[model samples]
Target: MGERYEYVPHRLLRRRVRDIASGVEGELMAVISENVSGVGAEHWVELAYVRGPSGREFTTSVGNIESAPGGEAG
Candidate 1:
């Protein structure tokens, strides 16, 4: 049998996220880039590109997002 997959809403990519480990709370930033379905149907995965306060770029999965405030779609 083939693996089942579901479509992720584009609105999810627009939401901002912050790293709880950074120790600074209540801060959010938009994802500059993403591959919504890089893993394909077999393994559903969503990746987002974000820039930290330090000006460092990193990738984080949608599931990892601590918070998602609905905003403009990227």
Candidate 2:
């Protein structure tokens, strides 16, 4: 793994994470596969789905988050 790679794939899903940029703490709801099409090509990527305290759902890059403090029971 690279020195800056902090995303632990197996352990992050359904866990709590804090968005380092926004400071919004929420549950790491899921990692979903998304298909994208480009110029004569196609690819898939995993996006992190998160639910905030207000019940809003949004997708963010896994690199933008970290494990929430006080462990996973949030």
Tell me the whole-model lDDT of each prediction, alpha carbons only.
0.45, 0.72
Give one digit per residue, the lDDT tens place, for model 1 in 1-74. Answer: 24344334544443455544443222233433322344544334554455655666565654455653432232
TM-score of each: 0.38, 0.71
Candidate 1, superposed: residue stretches over 4 Å from native? 1-16, 20-44, 68-74
RMSD of each: 7.5, 7.4
Consecutive 10-residue window with the lowest summed lDDT within model 1: 23-32
Q: After superposition, how far is residue 11 of candidate 1 from its true place, in Å?
A: 3.8
Candidate 2: global Cα-lDDT? 0.72
Clashes of 1: 0
Misplaced by over 4 Å in model 2 are 1-9
What does the lDDT read for residue 68 in candidate 1?
33
**Residue 62's lDDT in candidate 1:** 47
